[model samples]
Target chain A: MADLLTPENLVNALSLGALYALIAVGYTMVYGIIKLINFAHGEIYMLGAFWALLVVGMEQATGINLFVAIVPAMLLCAAVGMTVDWSAYLSLRRRLPLADGLSIGGLTLLGVGAIFYKLTGDTTHAWYSEAAHGVFGWSIVALVPVVMLALSIGEKGGMLGRSLGRVSSDRLSALITAIGMSLILQTLAQLVWGADYRAFPQESIPAWMNEPSFHLGDAPVLGKELTMWVVALAMMAGLHLLVSRTKIGTAMRACSMDQETAALMGISVDRVIAFTFLIGSGMAAVAGVLYSVKVGGNISFRMGYYPGLLAFAAAVLGGIGNIRGAMLGGVLIGFLQGFTGGTFTIPFLVMILVLLVLPRGILGEPQATRA
Target chain B: MLELKNVHVHYGKIHALKGVSLEVREGEIVTIIGANGAGKSTTLKTISGLLRPTEGEIRYEGGPIHLVQPSDIVARGLCHTPEGRRIFPELTVHENLDMGAYLRKDKSGIEKDREHVYEMFPILAERREQHGGTLSGGEQQMLAIARSIMSKPRLLMLDEPSLGLAPIIVQQIFEVIARLNREEGLTILLVEQNASLALKTAHRGYVFETGTVLMSDEASSLAANEQVRAAYLGSD
Candidate 1:
């Protein structure tokens, strides 16, 4: 308990809480628009880190520059993520109504999992090979075009928006979507990433960026932890700007408030919804990468579960559907975890206070209470 | 300015409009009268492009508008203030008015129209910031009319505007409708179960029974008709 009261613990709490807030934004955005608590969104984050690792790993394996390997790595991961949406989220969501699709999606994923484990059971001992040694040189340049293409496709009322819009309001559809999303993503992680923690070494990133420093203070301060928080804060600020100031952002807000009314107002609700998913998933992906870097480790596919839950917890703290609230809630949760984790009383007290103050989860949307 | 020729409408298994046809000439008021289950509301929905006719053509200003999205219909200057006051409850009165003129691009003109609406319904101007949900029933009804007027439609459609309103407020709303037709030269298609008020206010009337029109004549003549008075107005 005394150790937790130390300034070092406080700093750790703040940084971790900030990261939770950053990731919670993605969950909250998706929920705010569709009211879905995407269970597998955590997997999407995990997949992002793997993408970065894959690129850097391939670059090191082959005699390629860091610049060249990044392109294919991001592209491959993005394609995988998009595929996750297309094959699982879109396919099931489109085939039947929401309730039926959720059941079918779960069953189908389980069936696929059994097949995967059966096929790859013997190959578990094999090492990861460098498939693209000396692959083409491309920076994050290629990603811009791909994201733009995704934006365009989403604007055209892509499959998810079209199918879900038919059954219920955007809020209801989002909730169902998150459920289906979580299942598919969790299953994919279990099948592909396996149950082992896989990560790039600390030396993979720039040396200076990875180093931990202690300030000459009464208590210890970790520089590496501070950097992690700075990155998260930056991401949150950027997202806030993206949602508030831009044209697409305005359109997104319009869709969230009243989709049918937005459609009547000449804003294409489908396009806005698609953009929402892309941004949300993309944010989760970015968080995935940064989380790995901060921890100086690789993660199993299932790594997304704890953080996903925590991020969701943060969002609930903030008011699930409210963006600013989610961010604030995240920081609060982190601080609480930092102070009360090893000791029961303080954390328990904080949890009680939060529950009493906000029984609905920190930032949960008000309208979502109907269900 | 709007014509429905041999239009057919259905609600699930029940037919709502059995090949009903109607016309509203420019610069006039046309009212549709009927009992509870008659096709009065369906005709307005069809004309506003909310419902597509099962059979027949809907011509607007001689242009064939057989089928189109509802917003597009509003853009084409045919606006319908729907039945039972479908005001956005969460939004303020001013915001509701803004939504009414959603398709218009001219900022100055829109502001001007908003002011005009406020001038027309001073009560709305006073309650501009208040949420529609908090407003009284009569106030919400007034807001609905003001919202429709903000669209500045060439042809306005009102469905049961007088439904569930106090007698004085109903008279006030009908008076405003009459003024919009007489002074602004705005064509209107009003659907109502109140045959006396509709026929008295409108220039022409159509009597709907079940899903079809049983009689069509000048409003004053229909008001004087023995059958219309006996069956609808409860008059001698």
Candidate 2:
């Protein structure tokens, strides 16, 4: 009880919640578009952290500012994210029907993983060279605009978007695509980053900021956790603005509301869905970088899986498709997990509390129907 | 102007529309009337590009529009207000109207047109901030109609405007339709089960039975025809 009241616990709660919230939006958006929960979203999240780790590692050796290295890292991850969409998901939607695509994608991922393991010797650290780190700063800046433009073309002017324009309903094709996306990304990580637990260079900010402290009734309690809360709040605010104010954002909301109606209105439902996936995956990437920054990346291929589950749980707790609900649910769940650890029957207690308080999850809204 | 020639549409193996052909001239209120499962709605859906005919050609303004996307059809000046008021439930009433103008880029004119929708449906103006899902059925129907008009379509197709409405409310809807035709000179293709109400509202009508056209004539003649009276008017 004394530890629960400490400032460190509160801060940890906030940080974990914020991270979950960020990743959860990806799960929520994919679900909203196609009514399918993406089990592989966690792998994408892990890939993001690994990308940051790779970039930061290079910067550390090459005498470049590691902080400045983040720009290119983000761009690379975004490109990788879109590639995941195209190679795994988009191909599934185009080449074969949905069920066959899922089986093929899953099998292909397994085969690629085996090959990656054989080539890389199943080592995570060997992928990170101890020397020869050159600054890729110019290349990173040059690629950002090009990547953004490519994504736009893929979403808007691409043959996939055009062909699928009329079939605007929630589709099984989308689910198969998501599964294929998961396999492609995980395989890419295994091939490039190797199957190892690589760590980022030692940092002080997480330790210095995560120190907990509290004063209650003139008694001092120590160990504070505020950084995560601040990050989560900031991310939510930025996401709110991006979704509400942008043209693509408006089209996304319109697609969620009614695909047929949105298409008839000329909002380009396919392009909007693709854009939503891109933005949602981008958010997951940001969360990945932040996760590495705070925890000093000891990344695994499946590290994002647990976080993804928590985020999905958080998303459902608030309301599966509601954006604001996801944020609230994440924060609340973060606080719950923070306080419940090592407590009597912690898992059962948490489960009971969630069931009693939010049978639909922390932020779930009720169902709605129009006349 | 729209024309459907020898259209055959099937849902799975069940034939929903069997050899149905109809035409709507420019600047006219053309009503398609029938009993339930008479393929009335299927005809409208095929014409609007919502459902493709298994075999047929749909020509609009003298060009084939059968292969066009639904959005492209709207861009070509044909808009559809779907049955049972399929408005975007989560969006605010104003946002619902904005969605109707999704194709248009003229920001200032779009804003003005939004105001026009508000003026036409004064209740929509009052409850503009409310979600479309929260509105009453009658209001939802009105919002659906108003939202479609936001596209400024040359041809507006409505599927069953009088479904599940009070008699007084039905009268009000018909009045609005009459005013739209007279004042705005908008072409309408109305599908309704209520033959008497439809004839009163439309210039000409086609009576359909089991996926085939039974009769096509001026509304007044259709109203007075003995066979039409026995089959539809429900008068002895």
Candidate 3:
């Protein structure tokens, strides 16, 4: 027990918790606004890590400072996050009656399928078969926008529009779409990066970053751990100020509380949501880079899944929508996980126990009287 | 300053507004009185751009505003204090008020408006650091109205400000509303279930029944109408 509670383990726990807290904020913020789980958030973190790796590789060839990779990685990840929202969630939200929108999407798939068939022209011929398969590969590129336009117009005119407007229940569809997005992102990552674990070239990093900066008793604290702590805390503080003091941050809070009322207050809901994604993903990018450096310097297509789930658990543990709660939960979970030697069972049990005891989490507001 | 011509609104299969038409001239308090589902709130929502009208037009300052987004409408100085006083529960009163001035770039003007709001609802200023959810129902409503005024709206549309409040608190709210309109020349469109108080406060009144206007006239005439008195204004 004494060995487990050593200073080394405490530092490890803090760094790990800081990473989880960073990613958890993304989940919590997105959930706060739209009430969607944003299951693809983990993939954003993974992509950030990969982006950092790619940029670091460039640095090695050109002799640039490897630390400079953080900026582009964060920017790229933010763009990716925004694109995911634009392509997936926003498109569905704009279409009233998610079923109608889905059907239109289905029709577009069929249209593209037909176009592929025409291009193939008798698949019995080897050349034709290859052409058909190639066409099939590009169908999504050709058909998605076409279908979107058709449905958008249909939503604005005639009986279809009226009927579409009648179905106001979009929560279920949005949830399903979120899950689908997770699968799509995971699969795409696998296809692009393969399922192998690629080691980050730690030697390329500055020697000072890799060396121990200080010692606690027998435990030596590496400069990398110190860096992670400083960077994570700085980013968290920055986020807190941005949310609490900035105009856009205030708008985000208002939208989270009541979207229609926020809109009525002249706070553009769409703009606020987009900004939320940008900030959340940027933080996740920073977390991803730090995590890769600290944990064996390896990057994998599935690297984000376990940490992402743990961060989600951290968010829920801290009271999902409360920002401070997420931070607290992340640090607590990180310490607990470190103490337990990275076992899932203890953390999972903790989450369940916390839910059973305080269902609203630590900082959740008390239930208000229903009108 | 605002006109709705044959406006229709639908929520799923329920037609909330059926060709509801009304007008609010500059510097007037126009009240819409009705039962729970009589489309009074819907009419306010349509004008505020929270709900898009299915048919007809909403003209604000001589331009069609039916197609405009809600945020743009508020930016144009049309603020709606919505039903249920949807204040950000976790935000402090000061933060909530800050959110109200989101679109305004005039820092000094916003500060002046903030002072004016504080003057009107001194309780809000007293509890400026308290979260919105901690406030009482009456305080929340005051915060809602005070927050709206922070926007410096040209046309303020309030929905059911007295829905669930003590009679004394309700009276106080009405007094503030009347004062704002009287002193500041602020135009208002007030929706209320409290017909007697509404008619007393408004210059013009519209009686809404089952998604359409049943009558429109001067507030005193509507208060005197036998049908309106029997259906809406309870016998004293």
Candidate 4:
């Protein structure tokens, strides 16, 4: 008990809590807007970690510092997050017909092929390669648009029209898509950067990050932990201000309240959703870096799964859509995990117990209307 | 200021609006009085770009608006106060009003409009810090109208503003609408089930039944029409 009460344990708990809070905000905000649990968000966290590692590796070959790597990693992860929305979620939200989606997807693939054929310019010239590159590319450009145009023209044909009108009603499909996206991201990461854990190059990390910045009782507090706390707190403060004090933030809040009504108010619901993903993913990037640093630079394709699950648990524990709730939930879960043990059993049990008591989590507002 | 020509809307196989054509000139309060499921709300929604018409055109201020997004429609100064007082429940009254001016860039203009809204609805002013959900139904309706007015709209489309309110509150709301039309010269297209109150308040009226217009005339003529009275006004 005395050992648990030590300052060192307290600092560790706070650090862990801060990390969870940072990642949990993404889940909460996304859920707030679309009512979809973005299962792929954990993969975004993983990608951010890998991006940081990749950047750091480049820096070692070229002498760039760790701080400089943060922005690029964040930007790359943000792009991936937005792309996931555009490819998987947006069409479903718009209720575009599957046929339209297929045709559009085909057009997009054709465009990509055309671009590839143009860029590569048939240098190899083997019959299979030429057919694969040239014939397929040139044919798709003409064929796809004609097919799509015909579909558009024949839209009034009852059978085709009815077949094309299948639309998603709820968030279930999006949730499934998010899970599939997570798997795809994980597989791609494994293919690109082997399945084994890669240690973060400590030599490439700045001295300030690796060295002890101060002491808490008998234990020394690492610079990395201090950075995580400061950065996370700062980001939280900034996010709070943005959500409360800005026009975009107000629009976001309005959207979470009622999407159709928000759109009627001239708030671009789509833009706001994308912006939420960007901020959430960017924060996830920051958390990823701090987490990788704290874990002695070890990064694996599967590193994000447990932490991501814990953060999601944190989001639910706080109140899924409530920002402040996520912060509080993160702190509680971190403290529980850190003080009790690294194992997830206690935290998971706490989540279940808390949920059983407060059905909406700690701060989730009870929905007034069923719709 | 707004016109819909041969507009048709479909909800899957259910044709909600069939060749529904209407016009609202600038500074006029035009009302569409209809029974439940008569597509009055659908007409307003299509004009506001919440739902697209399967066929036809919507023109606002001589420009085609059918292809525009809802936000862009609002940005162009056409605001819709939807059927429900869908106020941001968790947001304070002031924040709700702020959201109304989401597309506006002029700080002074937005503030001025906000003040104007408060002046119009003194109850809202008194409860500026209160969460919208905490307000009474009448107060919520007032907030909804006040929120729409915060956009400084050239045309305001209101869908059933008197819904689920007491008689006295309904009178107060109509008076506010009259005052806005009289004083500000605001253009309004109101959809209502209360034919009596709507006809009294509007300059012109359209009577709807089963997704088609049954009659269109000056408000007084519609009020006096025997068919309208028998079906809608509950009069002999």
Q: Per-residue alpha-carbon lDDT of model 2 for A1-371, expressed as tens digits?
A: 67576655665566677788888888787667646677667776787776666665623544334445556655765665555554455543444433454455445545655675566454445344411221132233234334333333434446554555524322444554454455555545655565556656554223443343554445433232344445557768887887777656666777887777776665666567667667777778777767666665457665776677677777776677778877876766677776665232443356457758767665555566656
Per-residue lDDT over B1-236 for candidate 3, one digit per residue giving the tens place of the 0 to 100 score = 99999999998679999998899999999999988899998898888887889998999999999999988898888999999998888789999998899899999999999988998899999999999988999999999999999898989999999989999999999999999999999999999999999999999999999999989999999999999889887787
> Higher TM-score: candidate 1 or 4?
4
lDDT of 4 by residue, A1-371 (tens): 56676677778888889989999999999999998888888888888888888887822534556677788889989988887777667865786776665455444444533453455343343334334433443443345344443443345454543455423223444555566566656654554455567756766578887678998887788888899999999999999999999888888888998999999999999999999999999999988877888876468768889888999999999999999999999998999988875669999999999999998999887885611
TM-score of each: 0.69, 0.80, 0.87, 0.89
Comparing candidate 1 with candidate 3, which one achieves the higher DockQ? 3
Best by DockQ: 4
Best-fitting candidate, scored by lDDT? 4
lDDT-based ranking, best first? 4, 3, 2, 1
Scored against the true structure, residue A225 in model 3 reaches a CA lDDT of: 88
* lDDT measured at residue B179 in model 2 versus the true structure, 0 to 100: 82
Give the local distance difference test score of model 4. Answer: 0.83
Cα displacement (Å) at residue A17, model 1: 3.2
Model 4 misplaced stretches (Cα beyond 4 Å):
A1-8, A58-60, A102-169, A369-371
- Candidate 2 regions with alpha-carbon error over 4 angstroms: A57-184, A201-231, A242-250, A340-353
lDDT of candidate 2? 0.71
- Candidate 3 residue lDDT tens string, A234-307: 98999999998888888888888888888888888888999999999999998888788877646876788888
Top candidate by TM-score:
4
Clashes of each: 23, 22, 0, 1
**Per-residue lDDT over B60-175 for candidate 4, one digit per residue giving the tens place of the 0 to 100 score:** 99999999999999989999999978989988999999999888889999888888888889999999999899899999999999999988898999999999999999999999
